[model samples]
Target chain A: MILEPHQIELIGYAAAFLTTFAFVPQAIVSWRTRDLSGVSLGMYSLFTFGVGLWLIYGLIIEKWPLILANAITFALALSILVLKLRYPRK
Target chain B: MILEPHQIELIGYAAAFLTTFAFVPQAIVSWRTRDLSGVSLGMYSLFTFGVGLWLIYGLIIEKWPLILANAITFALALSILVLKLRYPRK
Candidate 1:
């Protein structure tokens, strides 16, 4: 089925805005607790790498929606990844 | 610049693998903490919604990369969103 242009644009906007701050809640909690005990550093490390790949895919596709969502998510994922590495389980 | 089909496939694989488990680390942490205190439900709520929109976008575009990434992400996001709501902070 075909989608209207506006509908597609709306998805793009939603994709951009939503994924941007997706990591905030976790970042804040991880920051506040300063505890990485329960947090999976290994998983996040790989996960962040995975996001990196997605960002590249987005770039390759040149789809604004994909690019925008991954770009924001990549940053957030990277930040959280740093924190996870910096502070391992106590 | 134009991209080869192989390059694009590589990206699709990467996107799928990366985002699929990207949420695992965070999910495990939240599960362990059971503390929604530091986590932001508002942000996650919107964030999940955002991912949902992206999934729609992905489906609409029929870009395997977009569809794969968002579908996995949507599931993870939804899981986290549920946890955030069910287990609100003290």
Candidate 2:
């Protein structure tokens, strides 16, 4: 079965929301508690860069889901990265 | 500039690798260090199920990047979820 552009967009939105929100709690918890024990510095660094690339890719293709999701994810990931650097596990 | 199927696949692959690998360090660190202080239980549960949905969506769309990325991600996320439950932050 072929899907129309809107249908595809719907899938994209669903995917985007799910993936993006997944990181919210991580960011909030880290910020509130000032804990970085389970966070990997390397991972967040790579992830922040990766999400930025994804945002660019999304813009190139004009996919709203990709752009919006990556934009927010980038922020969240960056925040966690900052926290990780600020408070290293002792 | 219009992109061919192959070009689109390239973007997908790039996105998939970056996003998927982003979680690798998290999983490995959590496993090795057995630290869950920074991990959010609600986040992982939602993420695990969300990635599973993404995998299904990818399968339905016949997109290899989505399928492969989500497959690996699901496993990694699930592992983290299990760890979250097994070793809650004290």
lDDT of each: 0.73, 0.83
* Candidate with the greatest lDDT versus the true structure: 2
Clashing pairs in 1: A50-B18
Superposed by TM-score, candidate 1 places the C-alpha of residue B73 at a distance from the truth, in angstroms, of 2.7
How far residue A23's Cα lies from its native spot in candidate 2, in Å, is 1.3
User: What value does the lDDT take at residue B69 in candidate 2?
Assistant: 88
lDDT of 1 by residue, B1-90 (tens): 787999889777866776676677778777877755545576678778887888888877778877877787788778777887888754
Q: Please provide TM-scores computed only on chain A for all of the candidate models, following their numbering.
A: 0.73, 0.81
Tell me the chain A TM-score of model 2.
0.81
Error of 2 at B28 (Å): 1.0
| C-alpha lDDT of candidate 1 relative to the true structure | 0.73
Task: In angstroms, give how far residue B14 of model 1 lies from its true place.
Answer: 1.5
In terms of docking quality, model 1 is medium
- TM-score of the second chain of model 2 compared to its true counterpart: 0.83
Q: Give the residue spans of candidate 1 off by over 4 A.
A: A1-3, A32-38, A59-69, B1-4, B32-39, B59-69
Question: In terms of TM-score, which candidate is strongest?
Answer: 2
